[model samples]
Target: MKQSLYIYNNGDLKRKDNTLQFTTYEGDKRDIPIERISDIYILSEMSFNTAFINYISQYGIPLHFFNYYNFYTGSYYPKESLLAGQLLVKQVEHYTCYDERLVIAKEFIKAAADNIYRNLRYYNSRGKDVAECMKEVNSLRKKLDHTEFIEELMGIEGNIRKNYYKAWNTIVNQEIQFEKRVMHPPDNMINSLISFVNSLIYAKTLSEIYHTQLDPTISYLHEQGFRRYSLCLDVSEVFKPLIGDRLIFSLLNKNQITEKSFTKELNFLHLKKEASRLIVTEFEKRMKQTIMHKELGKKVSYQYLIRLEAYKLIKHLIGEKEYEGFRIWW
Candidate 1:
């Protein structure tokens, strides 16, 4: 399996024949066999030549960029060789049908809610009094079926998340507090981590969607236009709790990360490069971790699950079957 390459230090990345090489200002150099690299994430200051981009494009390798504040700015995605005209038409067809689009969107929310409940239940079984929070989420879950507009569905989703976040302290036995969910500029460590993780997950999902011939620019749950890949954002909702939020709770409660890992300036909080890399590395580790998939009756890694989710979306687009995002039954 191809592994992702993360570059977080100052360096020069260039194409070395069929391989890629990274050389530091201090003169340390290393060559990476491009075949073993699926994606490259640039987290810190770095320079790359056009030759490197051209070489990576030949192999369909994407380059994701993050700023100093850990905010995802954009990506350089290689043109996919898997694009199909029929699949693109199917994707647009689904988006154009209100009832059909809402059904898929609702399924995404339901699966997301189930995963959120699973995470809560995981901690609750360990003695957290999350029953009350679960009850609130249950109420919101029922509202998904009754939602008439996208905004209404989003409101209920937000309410469920609010209830869930409130239960974090009890579930994790950690003093790490979350005042609220902040995205524009995360005001605290928790918010900062949340923003960064969600960004990565969104981009990862987009990359997966790119491989499936689905137009990532078209989406049902989130309004599509001006945004590059809004459909990935729509699907990422289902996995954020199972992947991103769970990792955040684990790292904070285990004392793996703390206030020291954050830097505050003018009320804006950001994870330091070292801390961000620590979280990203752990996230990548989680994606590589395997779990028994009940439907497939076999073990699959989190990364594969992501790709599977994208495949499911494509299946829905092509009218092969109704799309229901993955729900946790265990």
Candidate 2:
């Protein structure tokens, strides 16, 4: 598998004939093979010419950018190489038709809620005393199928997440004052961590979606809007509980990430470069972790699972198979 390239230092990235090269401000140079990179993550200031962009674009490598505060800025998505006009139409049709759209949207929430509940159960089994939160989440999940409108469904999802976040206080061993989920400049360490890690998951999903024929902007759960890939938001909702949240839980419980990991002077809004690198490294390892896939009768990495979700969506759009969101069976 091709690995993701992360740049956490000030540098200049240039296309060196067939390969890639990065030179730091101090004049240190390193060569990178273009074929070995799946995607690029820029966490610091970097400069590259059009020739570099053209080379990466030719190979369909996306570049995800983050601001100085470590918040996601945007991505440089390459042109679609695998375009299926019929599939695009079908994708739009599903979004335009309320009933069809609701079916896919509900599945996303159901899978997410189920995974959230599973996380609580995993912790409760380890004596984390999250049983009350588990009950609350389960009750709210049942109401998902009964929601008549999209608004009602979203309201239920919000409640389910609210209760899920409540359990974190007990699940984590650290003395974190995590009461609720907050974005738009997360107020606390937990909130800041959530925003940063979830952004990485969204970027990874976008990269996986690029390899497929699906249009990233067209989505079911989240409304399609300008300058956004809403389909990634929809697909990532199902995996965040399994991939992102679990990683957060592990990092905290094991004391791998602590309050000291963030910049206290920045109101805990800024994650230091070392902390960010550690999170990305652990996340990459988790993505490469494999589990036995029942349907395929073989093992598959967690990263491939995201691509499988996209393939499943394509099958649903083409009427080859019904869409069923991924739920943890392991």
Candidate 3:
């Protein structure tokens, strides 16, 4: 499998002959073969020469940039030829119909809620009092299937997510307390970790969207406009609870990510570049970890699980099959 390359430090990325090389400020050189890379994620202040950009474009590779605060800036997407006009029309057609769009949107929320419940159940089996929290979220989730309007469905989804977030501290098996979910300037270690992980999951979803024939700008759940890839946001909502939030709880509880990994600037808390990279590395590792897919009856990696979700959506759009998003049961 072609994997993603992450560059954090200020360095020069250039193509020498046919291979890619990164030269650090300390004059150390590391080379990577061009064929082995799928995408490049830049998490810190970095510079690349024309040769690097040109060669990446030749391979149709995308370079996504993030600022010091770990917020995504923009992407350097290469001009490519993988778009399908027929699929685009079907995507818009699905979005324009209220009944069609609502059905799809509700499924995403339900799958997300189901996964949130799965996380709670997994921990509860090991003796945590998550049943009360799960009951609240499950009640909110039931409203999704009955929602008549798009906004109402979205609201129900948000309410269920809030209840799911409330169960995190209880599942962590630690004494650290969480008042509320915070982002932008994360007030605590847990929030900071969640912010970083969610960003990675969003970017990963964007990458998956890019490869599909579906337009990322058009989405059912989120209002499509401006520079926002609304479809990516829609798809990301389904996986964040299962992939990103679970990782945060596990890492913090295990003491793998500690206070020493973060830095405070003024009132804003942020993870250092090294710390962010560590988290990203672990996230990619988790994505590669295999599990017995209940429906498939075989082991599948988490990363492929995400791609399968996208494929299911595409199938729904093109009328191949009814797309019921992945619901977590185990």
Candidate 4:
């Protein structure tokens, strides 16, 4: 698999004759072979001419941008290559039909809640005293099947996640206090990590969707709207608990990420460059790790697991099989 090329310094990006080159403002330059990159990430100040943008577009490589706060800003997505008009129509049908939309939406919530339960159970088995939180999660999750409307289903999903977040406080070290899920300048260290890592997962999901036939803008769980790819948001919910939150728990338990890694600017809490880099490195490591997939009967990288999920969605759209959001068994 090609790796994601991350640019995190002030630089000028330009084409280097079948390759990509970044020249830092300080006069340091590095070359990245175009064939070796799955995507590109612009994390710091950089300037690139139109020639470079048009060049990468030829390969359909997505460019994800992040602001200084390590918060995801947007992406320069190239035109979709896997544009199946039939699949697009089917995708819209799924969203337009209330019962059809609700089924898929509820499936996403069910899988996400199950994955969250997996994390809590893993900790509880180790004697973390998370029984109270687990009880709340189980109670809320049971409502998924009974929910009649998408709105009500989402309510249960929200409550389940809230209880899941509360369990984190008991699982991690006492030095870090994770009272609840907070964003809009994430008030604490754990919150900052949550925003930063969740953005990566979202971007990663979008990139995987680009390779599949399903339209990213047509989604069920999240209302499809302008200025955002909502399908990525729906697919990402399944993996965030699996990939993002699990990594967060591990980092905190091992003290790999500390409060020192954060900086407060006005009312916003942002991660320092070193801290952001550390988080990305750990995330990349986790994506490269493998698990034995019983259905596939082989080991697959966590990154490929995401692409497989996309393929599963496409199959569901085309009526080849049912779409069951990925729920972790191991």
Q: Number of backbone collisions per candidate, in order?
A: 0, 0, 0, 0
Q: Mind giving the per-residue lDDT tens digits that candidate 3 earns over 54-117?
A: 9998886888888877877778777645778898898899999989998898888888888888
State which candidate, 1 or 4, has the greater TM-score. Answer: 4
Per-residue alpha-carbon lDDT of candidate 4 for residues 1-330, written as tens digits (9 for 90 to 100): 699888889899999898889999999999888888888888999899999999899988899999988889999889988889998899998888999899889998999999999899999999898999999998889889999998899889989988998888888875666777888768888888899999999999888889888788888988777238998999998999889999998888888888777775433377888877888889999999999998999999898889999898888878899999898988
Clashing pairs in 1: none
Q: lDDT (0-100) at residue 243 of candidate 4? A: 98
lDDT of 2 by residue, 297-323 (tens): 999999999999999999999999999
Q: What is the TM-score of each candidate against the true structure?
A: 0.96, 0.99, 0.93, 0.97
Supply the TM-score for candidate 1. Answer: 0.96
Tens-digit lDDT track for model 1 on 1-330?
898898888889999888999998788999999999888888878888888889999988888899888889999978878988998888788889887778878888888988898888888888888999988888889888888877788888899899988887676555667757877777777777788889889878876776677777888888887368888888899989988988888887888888888775535466787888888889999989999998899999887888898888887777687788887666
| Backbone clash pairs in model 2 (N, Cα, C under 3 Å; residues 3+ apart or in different chains), count | 0
RMSD, one per candidate, in order:
1.5, 0.9, 1.9, 1.3
- lDDT for position 113 in model 1: 89
- Give the CA lDDT, 0 to 100, for residue 167 in model 4: 84
Over 4 Å off, model 4: 265-268
Report the error of model 4 at residue 108, Å. Answer: 0.4
Instruction: Give the best candidate by lDDT.
Output: 2
Error of 4 at 294 (Å): 0.8
Please give the RMSD of candidate 1 to the true structure. 1.5
